[model samples]
Target: MGSSWLPEDAEGKTLALVLGCGAAVLLLLVVVVVVWTRRRRRKPFDISLEDINNDPISVKSAPTSRTPSPKLPKRLSCPDAFQFPKQSLLVRSMTVDRVPDFTLPPERVQPRANGEKGANTTPLQYQQSLIGSLQPDLYSHSSSFSEEEDNYLPMSTYGRLWYSIVYDAAVEQLNVTLIKVKDLPGRGSHRFPRDPYVKIFLLPDDRTCRTSKVRKRTLSPIFNENFVFQVSEDDIKNRVLRFSVYDVDKRKVRHSLGHVIVPLRDVDLGHVDTYWSDLEPMTQALSSLGEIQMSLCYNPQTEKIKIGVMKARNLKHADFDQDTRFYLRVQLFYGRKIHRTKRTGSRGASVEMDMNESLSFSVAGKQMDSCRLEAALMMTAQRNGGMLTHDVEYGRVVMGPFMYARGEELIHWQEMQAQPRVPITRWHALTSNVSHD
Candidate 1:
């Protein structure tokens, strides 16, 4: 009887134990499912490198779907740039808009500082003298610019005097330059005749217009009336600054066509000496050849010096041909002496010299010892490239102090002594332009 009861109790206990274990397992599985759902919601989808690198396992390779999208360049832009139409573009002309207060009032015009006799030359008297001095031929021949009819008005101070005319030309867009006037004879002497040159430009107004597809623009004259220019410096002791309008196309130096004298006081003579050093070089040349023969370069206005090529052997026949090429250079010093040397070819031969602009054909000709050669270095405005070239029977050559057409008169050399002896190599320069009509 006890055995039967123990079996029944044991079975019941076993059944209960099995039911509890199954319930515990079900609760653990529910907790794990909830945790897994929460984790999946929080994390983003991630592709593993291993799966991406693996080849698709298929019994057959799949056909490309539709047309495969074209492979694009890594760089988004095309190699060639997108071009815009130039014809459609229009640049508006820039006008001065307004003229600032630039002129001096009549009351501000001060009496000449050099006293009445020096600076007080009446405007009417000055104009009379100026008109008297002009070459009528030049004024009549020059038709490009209008003739001056206004009475001359003396510009105020030296700063105003220098800047007024300069600014006026600049306003009208003309190429006018101011170089220091040099070699002014003291009081009443006229040995050094060098006068400072100011170049006037009557350029076509066509330059201001741009190319347009519809139509071409017409140009207008820069000024309607002739300008009366004058200067008054209270600093200059004896000589007064003066200016005149002359036509270069007509090729005339009418010193008085229209002139005004301004008395300048406290004039710095030190400024005049700045350009004096340029006179010392005469002519400088750079050559790759060992020898050269120099010919005097003369001013077209006054060809004071003439150069001829002569053979070292026959000092008589200075005539040269293509076959008789020699490096010949002659520098004329101060329009007096000719320094001709055998700049090229075989050395050890004595070259003969003759004066009077005549060639003496003799082997033992006497040397003109009295003649002295000096450099007449004058800084002038450049035309075209501002490079001067002379054509000779021998060959073409380059000149120094690379000058270009600009209003700048800045010195070529910092000091006379600082001038370079020989060019070590070629050099490039920046260009500047001026327009004062």
Candidate 2:
């Protein structure tokens, strides 16, 4: 109020002063920022390639394939190089003579794995023990052999039946041939004739005769249905045949016929056969003739398996259209046991279990001469009722067959000495590089 100036002029002058101060501050800030940025960009660095190289920090390179070095001796870490002898040291000293004198031939006395013959109580026992049990009526069929025969046959006076012989030469394999008898017995009204229409079955044992009989039908006296069987191979010098015959007409069955021994020459494996080792025995039982081949092999150097085969032929008569099952029945030991002793002797000799353990071979989906098959092994054991259920897991382990692979198609007892191979170590990097900043 002392210097009464116009309110508008005073206000305008104050606004101008404030605006000018702000503009000056902004200009100073812009200049300082520009100077600082320039100094930073132009500054000299003390770092050098040699200084960085002193540290020698190398960048790792990608891996590349390389021919692996030969495996070192046992002194080095090489599991594959470690080999097991053909025969175990612990059991090597033991000889056949040391075996019990009362033992029976392995073939004649089936292994416990094959349950009691003709007595089928095992399946019933298994069913009862299994979690999902089968109904008793499922297998319940109480038809006696006598009753079965009576129902199937209608008793009638004997008729003059016409018998025609047709040899399916293409389908039949002739191990032995019995030509039709030149002279026929005079027709007579005699029941069950003395010769009983004797038919000379050129039998080479159950396998040969059974294979032959299955393909043909004959009741002729010239054919010996009761012809004793024989197998004569030099290596396999003798084979005793024992089997039963069923008198279906008489409704009678007899087992354990006297043994028939036959001699044979040793077959040269190299020239004759093909062996499938990796395959399961059960597979052999089901395969077709064209597809299946009798295989053989031997491996002396165990680290890398080796094998040879002999005698491979097509099946003459196939039971099933396709073969899916197979079996290997090796007659490794032959002997008999005397009464009173559970043991047996050479005459009552059985298979040498150790020798069987040494045998190895392989099988594949397709025909293959030599192939490496992968293997995995595990053993299952049980606690005989003598042990407690809670301690069963820790009970004494009864080792079973060594498994090579797992799952539904698992194979057992695959020969480790002669088996597939695998790489033990990984590839290594070769190039070394460095990065600079």
Candidate 3:
């Protein structure tokens, strides 16, 4: 009974296997037929020599021995479904012609009776005569001029400043005397005068600034104050004198009036000379703090960046105690935010400092392109108690590929990217107004 049952089961199994094989064959045939049909329906994209020559392209069917070749159309036409306006096929010349003369001919005046003085005047001369009659002569009535027009200054000028400079070679000192100022403009609707003051700076060293006493409620003020600057005869030749005038309001906010710059190179330092100069418009000029030497390196393998602060030169010396120190603060910025900040060890304050320190930041290789660096030279002075210190930023420099950087700052960043794993070193000028972000 067991053998009989086994035989029956085996036969049934063999029949089921045969049916499955037949079904698989039928599915394979269907896939092959579908693929063949898709390939046959695909069209071939063909370009002939005529198309390369910019001639109209024509569609043609496959040629066979039993079928004649189709005729090619000379030109192609747009379909009615979407028609484009016809355009001229001729190429327009790009050469521009000279502008036509639009000036009108000078009008001629009829000759008057004999012995007339201006009968032959042209149109231009006649217009000039009318303008001359309307406008007052500035030079003709010098005594009648108001104080505002006394200096014959431009509209941008605020007023005039009178001062004198003398170089005392024996004492190795330069003396500047502020005489007076005239014709300051009214401040508000009340037409009240300003409480004005003068700030004196010997440029190339704005760290040391001198201020004059403020005079209240006066368009004209007599300072008559003398200030002294200690400098050698050789050093004075390279210096400049800047006078910035300001007006202080009730809220203690100072408003800039104007400025005057005098280069000492043009002055005769051997004798005293008084000069009057117009207070010209104010301009944003970068103060000369100094320069710093730095090196930048990026390693794509480790995804790290290194900034080396080698040294600083021509640093403005501060008149502080012996505990004064100088250091460099390096900040890495990403997405317009500070990612990391590192500072070098402080050194004694001097004209030149040798930091020779390097700082590192961990960053991904992809992030190097979006990162920027800011190096700021800082100064700290210890108070009398020595428990706390005061920190002041001398100057800062930005290095990146963005618009915040200019000149050498942008060039240095580009060099580092070009040469991977190599350090690019350069000297960057430090400015007082560099954006930290």
Candidate 4:
């Protein structure tokens, strides 16, 4: 019984001894750890310049703006805050200056990695070098051109107007027929386009007397129009018939293209009553505003002239006071005037009147061979007192001392002075754009 008991007891005692040894070892380790922790807590770790220099593994420290430590404590590898010394001659001798993929402008320095420049130069030293390399080519090139020459001079000469003149001796009227204006400039030059029209006036009167219908978007325009001017055959030489060409663009801007001035004296009335004139620059002429048919009758007994202004047709329409109601004003070459004769809402207007007033009757008291009968079509707003102002210029027309629609010599003065007859009627051409002084 004793032997059997002893085997179990021995095993138990052996297990107890192993457990006691492990407990003793654990207690000893805790005591050693507590003691070491207390000693480390009492003295803080520190680093110093002397320790750094003395160490075989020299570490580059950051700026000394931080407080310097007393002495360096042993570290696991090296503190990240310090720059470690090169371990081998390979790192010390080798240098790298990497090239960039893109080129920089000459004035600007190429920036690099590690914030280092062409050399191992300090950052401030590299910045100073950049100022010395800066150049001034940009400002130098910009200062060489003129501001005004870049404008205005590029636009130059264009082609001209050709026109002719005629005189009707039976009725004694000076007539200008704009046969056609040809050979004007062309459009291939990438130039500002010309919306060309011709305007004419008989001067010492700069007043614009008439304008041809504007021919749009062409460099060359053709207009066949007839214009008449009342002049004594002797007084014709003193007159200059002026023609002006213009570029009209109602959406953008308008400007004069050129002008041609032809003197009546320059034209030979005997064999050559009609000829072409060259168009030039800077000056121009006048027109009657529209077309009308009229009859003239002179009673030799009363010494009075009756002008039957039958009606106007193909009239240029105008809007004054933003509406199209119009009345008429008639005048003679000697400044004799007839006012407020008729009013009409249609573009075709009718104005008939007889003159009982004073008449200088050209070639005084003689048969009126040719006289300018001017009809100024006017407008008056209902809101205004119908008073005509100098600013109002709508349309104008001029008729002759001729038969209404007969196209024959019809000045009543000539018929009455020669042989009294019944009144004859004829259609008269009218021109427009009469400017008021």
Candidate 5:
């Protein structure tokens, strides 16, 4: 009876269409389920905020679909990030608006009896923030900086020192005194009552390592100690004084307190000078070429400045030559070939040399304004490395053209034209300043 009521040829066609639509819908549902399942299994996330979405290798490609996919939770990319997170270790001049006092994370295990180290367990963030911010600024901006803050004062427990260098023209020597080191900070890792001491050196001349006597059990030790370098006024300008402080451990290991570098050029040799220098860590490994000692003299009547290549000493040994040998080439500020020393051998394989020759340049009939003297120390020893088989640089040094000018208004030659004929002999340090003044 129902079939009769439905009554028509179109009824079969309608049922067929309905069945087709149902099959299509079912196929679509299966496809969606497969896609969603794969997506969930592919990237399940259980991570902290800092590392969340920090996928360096996972690059997102442009979606191929015309229809929008269902929206998942939006990832929290901090608004401050300009591009992808760089994870860069080096950045320039960060201005910290505030410094964070990062406390050590709660103990992973509370009992020291468990033999777990809780000291270094402090999260890296504590070492990465605040105090660490000042490190690059302190150590990097100026390698030649001698300021108290540039010395990393709060970064370590090693104390700071005040020192002075006086050049006695009469004696022809540099009287360097480690006037005092104050607030000689102690380290917790060491035993109490520290045996602290100080070591000094004139680099490229480590024939001597002048160290102060151990001041036992004193945090505030006063070492009014004096060390001497048999250097001329001209020669001292080219050297650097390296100062190091250490705690002599019971096992005889020198636990470093800190370090300080004083360029003798920075010292006012004209008078007895005192400077408060901050202590820094010995991070740079320095190699010595050698030390060059020379002197300068001005003859008014002859209108000539005479420079002598006195000697060089405490040279770094050349593996090529059983005997270290070198020579000197003197040049004026204007690139004039003034003089050259004789090709001589070291004295019986000694590192010292005695060059008795003098280099003379005529300043007569010319403006001697801002005259400078440069002496280059050259060596002829074969190299140990194959970088070069033959001769290479042993050392180089420079003295000032403007160093002794009387007046800026007058011609440099005119000022020296009528000056008293003083046979100026000063121990001048030689360095690699070959450029003309």
Candidate 6:
């Protein structure tokens, strides 16, 4: 038997295999063409030497032919070069271009008769002209301000009190009737309304004074209260009546709103005529508070200063409470600051207190000249069911070589300085202007 090169049935199989190989070869050729075309069209990243030289932030290097040697951007080494520019940028950003409303426009120079502009005016000359033009208006405004100032009265004159004084010769009594008060300045919206009352004092005899009933929550208070003063017909001419308006607080502290003084001699008291008077400012005087006695002794060898609170007399009873206790506070001041502070034991409140307490402070001899001594009388009273105690300053006295010490206080300091070892005792009238810590 003779065999052929391939089986006769393998013809179809060989033809199918050749067709599949041709399709695969065609697909591979198409992919290679597409890839080669894209590679030719795409651009290569190129950075030129001119661009690199123009950019200050770029790193400087020798020219390279092959694909600009990859270099990172360099940081600015000299930061100071940009400092002023940054500040200028900030200043420019903050600067406002708008002109203020108060500024005036620039004035143009007047033309000359020769058909030429006049010499340009200097800034100074233009300013002077502007000032001259504004002089009359400024003068008028200043005059109006002065008028307002003249009309402006202090807070003490914020209200007016109406009252009538009558002298009854038969009874030898001066009767004063307080009609009402008007136009009292309001304290504030947040604070409580003022509890206003009137106090009548016979001048030179303030020991005994009469007070009216308090009217609450009213700026204009109606106090139709009558107060009588026992005086002789001959003595009435020399007497002066003082009406003091006060506001009382919950703590029983009296704040003087205003006061008025009327001389009986000036008023025809025979007739019952009502008069209105504007209240005046209350004067703060040392003699009004009371008096205190203190002794000062300085030892140069030991560099110590001693203060002896001998006694206090004529202590003003501000609260008039029987259970009030009084104490003395001694403060040593150096260079306008309190260097040492000491207080005596509490004593029963009285017109005359016998303390006999001595307080000592260590101070250099050279510092004695600049040092000052302050003695304040304080009073404490039990309030709020005796659970809360309130301390109020009765009065104070200051002694030093400084300007704060005047009259007897200065003399006492000089005496103490002159006699170092010997104790210098002096009486000083207390003042109400006590410095509150």
| Each prediction's number of clashing residue pairs | 33, 64, 0, 27, 16, 0
Question: Which candidate, 3 or 6, has the higher lDDT?
Answer: 3
**Higher-ranked by TM-score: 3 or 6:** 3
Displacement of the residue 276 alpha carbon in candidate 6, Å: 23
List the candidates' TM-scores in order.
0.18, 0.15, 0.40, 0.29, 0.33, 0.36
- For 1-437, candidate 5 gives per-residue lDDT tens digits of 53566647678988999999999999999999999898888754544555645854333444555565679997755544545457943454678879977998865532233454444444565445546768765432222335554346463345677777778878888777776676766657563667888888776564466989888877667788888878766676766787877787777756667778777777777665467666765433232454555555567678777666566665544333554456676666644444333333333335666777677777653545455555566655445553544444455555553343211112223333445354344333333322111
- Point to the candidate with the largest TM-score: 3
lDDT of 2 by residue, 1-437 (tens): 68657688888999999999999999999999999988888753545656666744422133335564679765645443446554532332445756566966653322234554433445555445453445554533222223234335443222111111212233332232222221222234443322222122221222233311321222232332222233222312222111211112233221111111111222221221211111112222221211112222333334322221122223222222121122222222112211111111111111111111222333332312223232111112223552522210100111112222221112211322233442121111111011000
Query: Which candidate should be chosen as best, given lDDT against the real structure?
Result: 3
| Model 3 alpha-carbon drift over 4 Å, by segment | 1-123, 132-287, 434-437
> What tens digits encode model 3's per-residue C-alpha lDDT throughout 1-437?
53565677799999999999999999999999999888777723355566756733343444344476668976645344235445644433566588767988975565565676665777677667768877665423222224455457554348788788889999999888887887777797676889999989887565587899999998778898899999787778767788888888999867777778787888877656567777865433223456888998988888888898998876643544589888899898986899989999988888778889999988887776687888988888788679989887778888987445645687788788889899999888675532111
Superposed by TM-score, candidate 4 places the C-alpha of residue 379 at a distance from the truth, in angstroms, of 36
lDDT values for all models = 0.29, 0.27, 0.76, 0.54, 0.59, 0.75
Give the least accurate 10-residue stretch of model 6, judged by summed lDDT. 138-147
Model 1 C-alpha lDDT per residue in residues 1-437, reported as the tens digit of each score:
53665677799999999999999999999999999998888753354656555736422255555565679868725333324366644444667869877876664333555654436666776666568778676533222212241124332221111211221222332112232222222212433222222322211111121111111111110221223222123212322233322112223321211222322232332222111111111112111111122233222223232333322222221232222232333342212434443232222222232221211111111222223322111112223554653323312222222131111111221111133222121111111112111
> Any idea how many clashes model 2 has?
64
Compose the digit string of candidate 6's lDDT tens values, residues 155-179: 4446888788889999999988887
Superior candidate under TM-score, 2 versus 4 = 4
Which residue ranges in model 1 land beyond 4 Å of their true spot? 3-20, 23-25, 32-198, 201-398, 401-437
Root-mean-square deviation of each candidate, in angstroms? 28.1, 39.4, 24.1, 29.7, 27.4, 24.6
